[model samples]
Target chain A: MHPQLQLLVALQDMTGMIKEVEEKGSELEGMGFKTAGLDDLKRAREELEGQIEPQLMGAFQRLTAKFGRAVVPVVGNHCTGCFAQIPSSFVSKTNAGKLQRCESCGRILYWP
Target chain B: MDIAEVLKNTSPELFLPDLKATDKESALSELVAGLTAGMDIKNPDTILQMLQSRESLGSTAVGPGIAFPHGRTLAVQRLTILMARSTAGVDFDSEDGEPTHLFFVLIAPPQDLGHQYIKSLATLIDTVQEASLREKLMAADDYEAFCAALRGE
Candidate 1:
């Protein structure tokens, strides 16, 4: 269960890293002089993009392992995952894919 | 308009519409119109102008078939949200290279509540990106269907 939650956080950090590498690489390229550092940066960017897919898969796998599904859209006063009362309105709008915040904990709910 | 109020007002009736635009301008226009309509707010052009202003600064397309176009105005009392679905999708010069079909056009009354609006928007996106939700919206037939989709029934 912990792994499931942590996987999401990990995926977020990975995305952040990928973005930072990309921005840095672009900055280096904008300067437009081939250098060893730039080459390393390019390599890093390639590596990060490559990691994205595997990380995404890993995150999903972990979530499914914990919840028996990827993510559950809350249905009417219940956490689809935990079966608890989220606010009535929260349940109402989220099911419709409108404004969704977990009334109980404020996690954005998504329909599976 | 403050960006914060828009996110606060986001609800099912205001959330589900297929964007399916062929390009950015049409997509934004459709999105603004949809959000304004859902919230029952007056003057769609005012909100459209707000979105255009934001676009002038930079494209709101955040890539991966998503665009978060937003603006603020003093004439509004509350935030308004519009959702659009474009099965055909549109080009917003996104880095993700996936034609954008989902847009979260946010219009708000100017206020110090900007940060909360942004935070709520971020939260909304986190929810929207859930596995099949975007696809479900794309599959919807019309505005009514879109509303049903948002209501998650």
Candidate 2:
């Protein structure tokens, strides 16, 4: 993974957890989610955001807002984000450590 | 997702009828090991780190001796829900302050096209919350009987 892609993937994971907690905070309360830790989650998100570049961070926010997720993995010559067949050459580009995105969903792609 | 289908496609190794971890983090480590042993997940250390981070926010152990520790990561290709029962019970910091007996660990790749991750999570939450099902789950002796019990057989 490209260094930036690594950070982006981690940030994406953090963002997903933060969003889920924010969206389902109430439903998760007695279900054993410490709703009190919502602030802690937000703080953790901010911490992750701090380590990422502003441009990439902006792109992540915009993309996740447009789609459900900001980053996805490439699974078997296909972009799992949009289920689109990725050209074989594109896989090489990603493997060469170039930043890549799914042409269909416009979501960032990482070779996980 | 059909539990039976997932189990069949994956392996019965994912089902741990008797868990050996006694604490929250250890139980999660056991589940993560089972996940890797049973499926084609890569980067389990990262998976364990993410799961621990989720637990730091809140204990998933709640409602009638059940714990649902779940996370989304780049490590997996699809949604996976694995079950493990600790006969002696693991202390998962349950909300009701009871020892957690049943564990449902949900792992998903970030690209959940059909939202199966959340939907399956909701279903598991609803299913295990029922006292009747929890009892059946605990009583199941092996993976096959466990699947049957889950399917209400």
Candidate 3:
């Protein structure tokens, strides 16, 4: 994977983690569980965001806000996020390590 | 290789019914605690963290009230599967926006060269995707019935 794509994948994973921790943090605190991981993940996300390209970062944030996941795997020519079948041309571009977005869902697509 | 065979190899002690947790984190902690008590796991906290990290990637809830929360960790010697059911349901952040009632927590070693881990995962996903089987599993009154449900009995 390209360094930028790798960074975006990391950022996406971190975003997911941050969301989960925030959503469940209060409930966990009520149960006496330490939520320090949430802070660490948030900081990590910020650091990752700094590494990604500005335009890509903006797109990522927008897609993540719209759909819980911004980067989705293309499995057998289908965008796993939206279950939409991607064109073979897009699949080839993704396989070539180009950062591409699904025409249907607008989520970043990668071949895993 | 089949899901029933996989469940058969897993300890009966891991199948839990009527789990009391009302939310995802508590439900996860409860399952990790069970693993700590029954298995050779040394650090429950670390294992819980790993599972939570995996959950952050996506809500494991595959749909129809079942969620598969899994992680690869160094704490286990082999692939370990723990099953739990919450009749009251828990907010697992499922894509369908419905409360989740069934959870299958799968823990695997960091290195699964034989590909047994993914195969088991695929089997679990295929098995649960069957609405009839899921219904039977959910309607089961006890562990034995649960096993029978998995066995397609």
Candidate 4:
């Protein structure tokens, strides 16, 4: 993966974790149970977000707002995020470590 | 935690005794659609993407015919859970190689506090640990039966 794509993937994962932690925290609070680790995850996400370029970050945020997950894996020449099959040429570009987006879903595409 | 209390706030309408999807992807889409229907979800497509992304990380199928397909997204106002059963069973890429029969779709907000969501998931997993409990849930004919079985009645 390209360096930026790598960072975006990590950022997406972190964002997902943050959401999970927050949900768990709310559940625990409802049960009168205390929890932790959410702040650290948020901080981590912030730091990760800061490391990416503004343009790329903007794209990520836009895609995330539109698709929930801005970065998704390309599985079997298909954008698993939207189930759209990409052309072989596009897959080659992705395999060559180029950043790509699914034409249908518009989520960032990476070769896992 | 008391299972009933933990799930008390969950909407009973989210539980589906007869899921209609024949595959994992379609099942997820169906579940998400059902969960977001009539709600103010900004983007149902995005929510489905989030859930699919999580599944790609690894199948949530724990074992014994149960799968917990969950995702965190800002599309919803708060944490939500939807449960469904596939009588015909669907391949969820379970590690155990068994077809998944029960699905607990959990959706949480991006900024959630974290306690209630985790606790609810843990409670659900623990409750279904009993083989009989799994059987009862699978055999439940209606929503009431499903709730009763979940409550260990």
DockQ (C-alpha based) per candidate is 0.02, 0.44, 0.03, 0.06
User: What CAPRI class is candidate 4?
Assistant: incorrect
lDDT of 2 by residue, B1-153 (tens): 654444443347778889899898799989999998888775676678678778878788756798888878887777777788999999999878889999888888765656676666666676666688778888887888888887778
Instruction: For candidate 3, give the lDDT.
Output: 0.72
CA RMSD per model (angstroms): 18.0, 3.7, 13.9, 11.9
**Deviating ranges (above 4 Å) for candidate 4:** A1-14, A18-112
Residue pairs of candidate 2 with colliding backbone atoms: none
Write out the backbone clash pairs for model 3: none
Candidate 1 Cα errors over 4 Å, as ranges: A1-112, B1-8, B11-16, B39-42, B112-114, B140-153
Q: How close is candidate 3 to the true structure, as a TM-score?
A: 0.58
The lDDT leader among the candidates is 2
Model 3 lDDT tens row, B35-138: 78767664466567667766655567766798878655545657888888988999998878899999888877534556465567667776777888878888
Off by over 4 Å in 2: A1-4, A30-32, A53-68, A80-107, B1-11, B111-114, B129-135
| Candidate 1 local lDDT, residue B82 | 64
DockQ metric, candidate 1: 0.02
How much is the lDDT of residue B17 in candidate 2?
Answer: 84
lDDT tens string, model 1, A1-112? 2233333322332333334335443532332211233344345435544554565556555654655444344444566556667765643544443534345544434421
Model 2 chain A, poorest ten-residue lDDT window?
Answer: A27-36
List candidate 3 segments past 4 Å from native: A1-112
**lDDT (Cα, tens digit) per residue for candidate 3, span A2-104:** 5676677666545544554566556434422344556656766688789989998888888878886677766678887789999888646545667778888
lDDT-superior candidate, 2 or 4: 2
Model 2 per-residue lDDT at A96? 78
